[model samples]
Target: MISGVLISTLKAQQASVLQLRNWRTLNLRRTVVSPRIAHLRHRHLRQKSIPVAANIISEFRKANVRCTPSGEKIFKQAYAKAPANTFSCSWELYSPLWTTIRGEDTPDSLCYRNLNVSSARQWRSRQAYDICISFKVYKVWEALYTNSNIFRQLIDDQEKDCRDFSRCCMALQPLWLWLKLVVKEGLVERGDVDQLPEPSMLRDVVIGSGDPPDAVDLGLVNPAMCH
Candidate 1:
């Protein structure tokens, strides 16, 4: 009876040891697997941002804005102004520079228009606004492309903002139609119109009962707006 009892006790101890070994193996595997998963996620994000970065660069280039070495210098200088982690990407840090350039009353103010001289004269052309704004927003993307850590966050932010921009443009459907008519009829000057057609102008053309909303082609609003 004593010998039987000893054998059973030894068997139980061996089983416990085997169970512990299996648990440790699983833990080791998880530790190794977790990092591999994270690396793959990072790679996917980088791949996605590459094209986005290229598109952004192309947009700026259309406006004759260069984002190579000079832009890099500007980016680094501006980066110091923002607090740590305040900006997800360097582009966010560099955005203020573009805005500052826009507000300044310098030759470069119209420089955004230099991309196409003819388009510059046409304030009614949505392309002009897009070209100009692209130049302004280029610095942020340029910086983002240079930094991998922040680039992932930038892709997420841009995706979310894209939806917002689309929604906002859609909500302005009524105004969009009005602007089209204004542009078509030349009521709004092709040049010299710095902002949206005056609210009063929109009210007069659409609400005055002289012309119905259907009179204007909504397709003229440039589906995306000048974002």
Candidate 2:
């Protein structure tokens, strides 16, 4: 009778252990697997909602700015690594501006000399008006290379707070001036546009209110070329 009792006890213990194991497996599926699956599904939906622009990619190709398959892959990888809230700038404004960089391959001396003369001419035209601040924005070219970190930092800074028109333009002017300085100083090279922000992104910072700053009516663009 003792042997029979021992056998029954052993059976009961094995059953209990097996039951506990099953419960644990089910619990893990519920707590871990399900949440992971849901997260993946959410990511997929977000990606689907934000489609990459085919036309912009095509324009890059047209400009002889084609990325290698690996490079394209890395670009996508970078995008994936960025936070979901990261801002993407517009290609329409960016493309036209980049295309205007005609002399990126020219020597620094020649570029600087031309810009100097141009600045002088503009300055003379505006000598009658009191200059509030010397605001300048330079064209971004494929040749003027900056690292991705600069663009990332700029976007991060812009997103930290909402900007109105004057605030937005003020933010952009400094960055644009810096980009020109970077190129003129030969800190970057031809086709080194790794850090170039999209024009749309620039626009967002410069005119966040979807309108021009208060000075626009004062002939900010022409302003006697200064006004």
Candidate 3:
């Protein structure tokens, strides 16, 4: 087991790298006020704030900080802040720095960029799974109408409450799904799971332990043992 001091230190480090911010300063969400469906294209590329949260949540999962619910909450909050039309309304065309949860640069954040862990689960999109099973609104913004400017304001101006930022991220469910498959294929790793101490079973015990809670690729075993 990791010592208490180490855990604290690790958490502190993660906190410094994994943060949410008030992105409500500049006006990213600009439109002519028309109901044009074509206007809302691949919204993620257009807005920096929502993706900023998306990147943060991906980092959290890499860190393994109960990100499923956390991601869901942040999505809901962000959705509340966005305008009533398509979610692509916000645009932080200038900001390049992505902040951490504790309000610092995210250079130290974990990188499970590939999504390789089969044992892990990701937050389902509001459109996919019922929120009843999902965690409570990370904050009130979770339930906000997608068309509200509040959703856009939170990302361009200031950091909405942690939960509020989470709300906006709800729209990025597909991104998480892609990560899951990529991680499972050994393309990426979650920081939390990777950072976890080796299981007691792996220490001195032989292979062939009972089934792991999550699927493990049997091929990873030593070739000599498989025969």
Candidate 4:
């Protein structure tokens, strides 16, 4: 009887040890696999969204510029004497305005170099006036989306939130700026701007719905959210 009781006790201890070992192995697997699964999920979503985003951008590029209410107001104010039925500004003229705005001198150089008309007759020319008004209106629109403070915060947060995704965010910045410009200019609807996919973690911050206090202060939030 003593030998049998000893054998039974030994078997019970062995079973407890095995159970503990199995639990630890299961936990270890979970620890290792969880992050990998998360990373793969992120990559999958990004891949799926890319082609859709590219198509949207391609369509936006092909679409002609149509002034929003704000853009129309800008146009009328800039060309009060011109006929109401004036045609949309040609892309040839509009394209150079972006280059000028991105330049170091910016509005100063834009004003003095392109818009400095020596006479009222020079100002009266539609081509010259188009350049001036387009620059002025776009400059204002650029500030709305590219607030220096908000952009700096975006970079900082991108590094903190996900270092791996930072490079992707940097690459997308120019495209984002272009999208914002078209939206503000009334060339594209705010709904269209919302279709561009961003990383799940950074989407709120980029679109101005995140915890960044500066976004609200600077009015850097995407206009779509307000509606």
Candidate 5:
């Protein structure tokens, strides 16, 4: 009876050892496999996102727009007056510039055509307004583009705020449209587009003061507002 009991005890200890070894093997496999799976998932996501970002950037480069010398000067002056933390030009800066550009003594509201004044007096043509706003938009973009560090920061901020790279790219659409309008209005010559800042230098800017909650809309140059 004693011999049998001792044998039984020895078998039980051996079984426990085997069970522990099997458990360790299983745990070790999980530890190794989980991270490999995670790495592959991360790489797959990165691969998927790269093309979308590349396409957006490629499309943006196709705008082929540049700021006029006068526009560049104006942007420089405005940038100088802006706060150090200012990432984009504001309407406060643009408004005064517009007034100066218009050379009008009229109230700001009237100058912007916000008032429903009598039609008896001649007003600026819609095309004229379009050109003016488009010029301003082009200059703002040029200013940002020339300052590559700020431009990249602006894009990075937009990406963080939206948490979507595509949406960050979309924020640039209004600027692109306004740029195309600048080209359409003959403000920028086709030859000048070739001289635009490098594609890597491109970035987005708000046409007005304060950062919006999401993407930067058309601001003063909204199509509906233009019409």
Candidate 6:
């Protein structure tokens, strides 16, 4: 009985020491997780670029510029005048104004893929959206694209695609700015975009339903989509 008691006392002492060590180490683990935290932050940053692009597009919506609807008509018009074998003016002038590009490019500087029928149609659709945003933003500020310095540098490349274009816009401005601007301009109203619903008429009006009511409605995103 005496031996067992001594052994038990020793074990208890060891266990107490272990527990103390664990307690002390917990703080170190929490403090030293910088790498993991940084990785998580990078992942979050990568995830955020799309919404930022979308928001930048939305910002131009309020500027109320001349926007042509994306459909056969606008596509045909832009296509009809597309520079054949590297001619310029009129249509190409419209291209820079609406493409949000720094300047026009020659065949070598700006190369466009000859997408198949469906892909070409899709490309036109995307270009229409770009045009709408660009026109509005341009009208709001004649230097709208020039403000996006990255875009200014990209015009010379001519090989950039939709992904590159969208990514460039995302890098220009944080998406949160778009949400805030709509609220400020009274275009979006309140609650639907910010924190929570309040006990008032505006609450019911803005936040019709759902958590984080202000969340951007992305509508049927494809895994391969860059938009």
Q: Write the per-residue lDDT of candidate 3 for residues 94-149, one digit (tens) a residue.
A: 12111112343233232344223233544345433224212212211221212234
Candidate 2: stretches off by over 4 Å:
1-12, 15-138, 141-162, 165-174, 189-227
Evaluated with lDDT, which candidate comes out highest?
5
Could you give candidate 6's per-residue lDDT for residues 51-121 as a string of tens digits? 32233234333332212222112224333434432112222433422342223221111112423323433
Per-model CA lDDT versus the true structure? 0.42, 0.41, 0.34, 0.41, 0.46, 0.35
- Looking at model 6, residue 14 earns an lDDT score of 100
Off by over 4 Å in 4: 49-227
| TM-score for each candidate, following the candidate numbering | 0.32, 0.30, 0.18, 0.24, 0.27, 0.23
Per-residue lDDT of model 4, residues 1-227, tens digit only: 57988999999999999999999999999999999999999998775554322333333333322334443333333334333222122222234324433442322122323545234325546657545444433332333234333323433443343334332332234333443344434434433333323333323345534654333333334434545
Index of the highest-TM-score prediction: 1
Which model is ahead, 2 or 4, in terms of TM-score?
Answer: 2
Weakest lDDT window of 10 consecutive positions for candidate 6: 103-112
Model 1 lDDT, residue 144, Cα: 33
Residue 130 miss distance in model 6 (angstroms): 19
lDDT of 2 by residue, 1-227 (tens): 56988999999999999999999999988998888899999998876566233322343444334444433343343344333343344222233323433323423321423445245434333432223122212224221123233254453343332243333343244444434433433323324343445434443345545343344432244424433
Please list the residue runs of candidate 6 whose C-alpha ends up more than 4 Å from where it truly belongs after superposition.
34-39, 42-46, 49-227
lDDT measured at residue 58 in model 3 versus the true structure, 0 to 100 = 48
Q: How accurate locally is residue 163 in candidate 2, as Cα lDDT from 0 to 100?
A: 44
- List RMSD in Å for every model shown: 13.3, 12.3, 28.2, 17.8, 15.4, 20.4
Model 3 misplaced regions, further than 4 Å: 1-39, 42-44, 47-59, 62-219
Q: Evaluate residue 62 in candidate 6 and report its C-alpha lDDT on the 0 to 100 scale.
A: 37
Give candidate 1 regions above 4 Å deviation. 2-8, 27-35, 41-72, 79-95, 98-227
Q: Model 5: what TM-score?
A: 0.27
Model 6 RMSD in Å is 20.4
